[model samples]
Target chain A: MSRLSGTGLTLAYDKRVIAEQLSVEIPDGSFTVIIGPNACGKSTLLRALSRLLKPAAGTVLLDGGDVHSLPTRTVARTLGLLPQSSTAPDGITVAELVARGRYPHQGLLRRWSERDEQVVTESMAATGVGDLADRNVDELSGGQRQRVWIAMALAQQTPLLLLDEPTTYLDIAHQIEVLDLCAELHERQGRTLVAVLHDLNHAARYATHLIAMRDGKVARSGPPGEVLTAALVEEVFGLPCRVIDDPETGTPLVVPAARRKTSVQAEV
Target chain B: MSKVMVIRPRAVVIGAGALLAMTAVAVLTLGTGDFPIAPADVVKTLAGQGNAAQTFIINELRLPRVVTAILVGMALAAGGAVFQSITRNPLGSPDILGITSGAGAAALAVVILGGSSTALSLAAITGGIGTALLIQLIGGRRGLQGYRFILIGVGMTAILNGIMGWLLTKGVQMENARALLWLAGSFDGRGWEEALPLLGVLIVTIPILAVVCGPGLRMLEMGDDVAAGLGVPVKRLRNGALLVASLVVACAAAAAGPVNFVALIAPNIARRVTRAPGPNLLPSMAIGALLTVAADWLAMHSGYPLPVGVVTGGLGGAYLVWLLISERKAGRI
Candidate 1:
């Protein structure tokens, strides 16, 4: 059974509606990736599920309780989110930045316990940022900085974690590095992970369950083997593509169809 | 159980040092005026061991001005740190948020109307708070997000400055001089009447801000989405901090008539001294008290007895120019 789910959600910014009555479920202990073309509302759906954006209509359920109805700190203890863009304060060290994730577990009188210190250390180690704890976050490479951010989310120690395009703006190798870390957290730590990704192949490779969106609605959602196909990719992304198994992992790989060479040859 | 609170040694050292320096300056100021009490005698007077005449001079004549200067400095500095953190810009002090301009305009109006000092103080506070509410209503639709709030505040400051100029023109010569003296910001002749109210507000608000809100506000420096994701009620915290900070600024204005640059420069100086990230609220307060007390001492000792505001304004203008150049060199402007 799913622990986090949304029903009949109508998302919008101001007067402009982005989705209407959209429903989704994130399977417990599964690596679920939501993929869609630009402006397809995947990130908005993630925001609503994380309770960063309140839905105009309907409810987001966490463990059968309405998420919006719960105390924000209570919800935060159970769920952590890594937003698409967040700036580290000027001159903040990696450890200091990661320690901020303890906010939900902290209070006015009960700040920075032994457990908090242990968790921050473990989170940094788990993300391979332990050695860089003293380094200024502003001076880190993009890949290292992304790892530090993930460490911060890990420090929250929540069972469920949401990432909004966590791989954007990174190079291909860094993207793979970040995805591998997410996969490791899902596999080794048993975190129920939800990520909105732009790369179809990466989603297919890393995601145990996939949700493909078109316009403002879910086009298909299932295991990648069943949901990712040439026709589905064409329909959802409006791209003519061929789907083949990834040689390394046997997951679906989308290769866009090459354009005809007649017009190019004539121009040349 | 051993509570493992994060503590920076450097900040602690800086805070302690600033407190010591501030006390030294305050004591020296108390001893240096026309009566010329020695520092030892000033300490004795503070300890209630001085003769009646010295006691009267210290308690009745000089102590109130020093206390008011310290309180106003602490208030403005704390307010400045809050604004800078919220806006994530060094220039985002209470002055930039139009608090000083609003208070100045209202006080000018009172001076022109030949109001009593008590009425003038009340008017200044009311005007500052009213401007804050208006700015929040207009620019806070999307929460107190960064550049938009600063831009709106700049616009409000411009409008209020125009009003202040027109009011000055409408006043007679004597009234204009009175208004200008108040505008220049001073602690001359101020007594417990001003210091007590400011102290009361600071006593209630500063602890709450430092203990309850400081960590949450630090989280906000990461951005709204991140802070919210971390379970901070971002809008509520921002609004609450803004209101509390505005009230502090208004009260300081009432006490000292819109002292310039203490709010603008204190937080930055505190940050540099401690070399710590986040708002550095406590350090800012200490540094602010030191800066004001020191400046007031210099003004009192400068032979001609210039207003404290003139000294700060002149020094702050130079500091601002240096700040712009340094920020530009760092490519942060």
Candidate 2:
């Protein structure tokens, strides 16, 4: 069963249509990863689902109601999104930045409360940024900064979280660290996690549900073991590859075909 | 790590200090002049204990000008804080962004065309709102963000300044002299007529800014996507803030003839003093009142009297140059 789903969503910016008649569903309590080639409308779909981009046609339903029709704050209390890039206000501390996530729950009369303070503390600790609370966000490393941003989303305390290319700018180790944190949130906290990722192997290894896209359409989606076959990868990503089981996790992994040795050589 | 407190004690202390300083300047300003009432006498007169002559001087002659200065300063600073926060740029105050220039040009037009003071005020407000809408239209539908909006505003300011200079040239000798004095931004001959209107604007706008828009604007500094993801109505909030800020800048311009840099410098100074990020609206308003009152006092006491605008213009110009140099050194520009 799924609590968040889209039906016939047509997403566009200005006059340029990125996708038409697209539909998707995020399973309840699953770590879902979406992977596709560049400009395949993966991020557009995520934006539509998160209600950042209003769909030109059709609807995104959250809990059997149109998400766009609901009050924004009400939707925010149930769902959170970490955008691809967000600027930290200059001279902001890690704790202050995380505490801003409690905005939806706060109001003019209802200022910051003890619950807000406790939530901010726990969010920072969950993302291993408790010690960096007093440090400036500008002074943190890329990996630590990413963790702080995730901690902010965690502070929102939404049951459903969507991240658009959360690991895009990080080193490989940081990418894996972030993915591990997402996986932990899904497994231990039973939060529904949907993320767009570039690394196919990581997506396959970590995602309980995998979605592959091509030309603004979902080419295949299911359990990673069922959806991440060599044929679907070749069709979706246009890469000639062989699929093999990962030794440690027993999940399907792709190995690109080796290029033939060139016979023509330039004279030195 | 130590617990991070939501409220900063330093900001509260600085706010209190600024309020006290403003009160001191107000009292001192009321006491100085050719009549030269003592500060103690000024306080007593304010409390209804003064002699008839002292009461007439304090109540009738000088008090209105001081009130106008305070209200104009608060309006300008509040407007500046809103614009800077919205654009996320320190250089995005009303004066730099052409908002005051728009009001100045309209007020100049009314003066040159022999309009009443009431017409002048209304015209200034219309001009300010029109300029904001023009900038918004040209800035495109992407909403107010980044350096693009600031650059467009800078361009608009240049155009409006040229218009103002041309308008000044068209007036007759007597009208030209009057327009020039107004352009220099003086408190001479100002009375309850000017102060009351500004007070009305403040009463209407300040509460809305504090209670409705403050928290959402703070969220907007993180970027639009993050703000929207947190459920802030981004477009509506930006437009509403721009409208309120334009009204403020226009009203202050009508009262004080575009008093140079209180709007540009007050919020920046408040942010530095408080050592807090975001708009710093209340502190900025307090510091603004202090700066204007202090500048007016200096203008009155200087061996050669000058318009209050000249004092602020010289100081603000220097501050601008220093800010540019420091921002360049910091690699922010």
Candidate 3:
């Protein structure tokens, strides 16, 4: 069974509705990817699932209990979240940044434990930031900084994880490094993942289940092979496309239609 | 595991060590008066068994002064750190929020109207808290973005200063001299009568500082959305910090008259020394005490009888310039 499910969910900012009558179930241990154009409510839906945003009409349930009513630490213990960017205090080391993920577990009289250290170390190693632990987070490269954030999320030691636009602003190599790490986390660590992604190719390649959203609605939901058709891409994105199987992995590939700027005489 | 456990304990250990150093330096702070005492005799006086003349010099006179310095320092710095955390600004302090301005005017009113000392303290506390509230109302919910609160506070401070200046000019010489009692911030001429009242506030406020402000501060630093998402009651935390900060400044100012900049510089320095976001409160208290004691020593013994506020106020302005230049260099401001 999936750990997080939003039912009959309607989300909006103030009075402007972003997603209406929305419903989704993020499967346990499954890499689920949400892909859509900008302003398509993908991030909003993710926030609703993560309990960061309140749904206007319905509730997000965690294992059959309302997430809002459950203690924040309880939800945090079960589900970890990595926002697009995290702010760190000045001169804060990567290790310290990661250690903050253990805050929900700490208290006034309680002390740090070997288990916390182990979790923090393993998270850093898993995210390939083990060597960068002592370095200041703000001084690191964008890619390295992102890894430090992931290490923080991993340090949370949650069974389910949600990420919003985790690949934004990265070059091709760094993008793959991030996605590949996410893939490793899903494949090896068996952590449930729900990510909002812009790159459909990356989404199809990594996602076990894909949900393509459009104009405040889920346009299609299924395995990538059947749901991610050229027709569906054109309808959802308002762009024409050609679909083909990926050479590296057998998943739908989307190529958008383009217009020639010049006719034959103009080109001449 | 060992490292993590070790660092927290070390912060406390080093904090206590700083406290001890401050106490020893405080001993030097004594004997700064016209008649000096031997260090051993000062210690003997401190232990409550010394010769009569030394006892009168140290216990009857200097001891209360030292305690006053410690109380003012702790009150201002600890209050500043809490306010800065909740507001998420390096510049936030009780004085910057117009608390001191209100206290000054209120204390002036008490003296001009011949209010009792206890009534005077009450009036000052109420006035200080009210002024802080007034600034927050004018500045609104976006406290730090445009320096609106600070600018508004400077205006309030100027108004209060004008009122104090006018009141001083209006009085007869003897009345003016009595009014002047509140003007120069001093540990001079104080006794346990002054220290005792402050002790009550310290006992009530310090535990509240430990239990309430510490955790809520961490949440406040990450912005409202993130803090609220983390389940910190953001509004409550902010308002509580403001309330506590107001009370602290008012009580300290009532006890010692205003001592400037210990609040501003102490927390900033403590944060740097600890390498943490908000100043570690305990260390900040220790540092504040050191700063006040140091300033008092300079005030009493620096070849002239300067008010401690003059030294500290000058220090605060220079620090402001330094912070501005450094921030401009770093491209943060």
DockQ for every model, please: 0.61, 0.69, 0.27
List, residue by residue over B249-329, the lDDT tens digit for candidate 1: 889999998889899999999888787788899999999999999999999988986888888788888888998899889
Clashing pairs in 1: none
Question: Tens-digit lDDT track for model 3 on B1-333?
Answer: 332232455557667876887888799888667788877778888898988888888887888889988888888888887766665556777777668878878887788877788877888888888887887777756544346666777788888888888877777777667667566676777678878878788788877876666765665565554444444555666777778778888888888777787777887877777776544788888888888888888888778778888888888879978977986898766
Chain B TM-score in each of the candidates: 0.95, 0.97, 0.92
Model 1, span A180-254: residue lDDT tens: 999999999999999999999999999999999988899999999999999999999889999998999999999
C-alpha lDDT of residue B70 in model 2? 91
TM-score, one value per model:
0.96, 0.96, 0.88
TM-score of 3: 0.88
lDDT of 2 by residue, A124-216 (tens): 999999999999999999999999999999999999999999998899999989999999999988999999999999999999999899998
The ten-residue window of minimal lDDT in model 1 chain B covers B1-10
Give me the runs in candidate 3 sitting further than 4 Å from their true place. Answer: A8-21, A262-268, B1-17, B105-113, B131-184, B219-235, B302-304
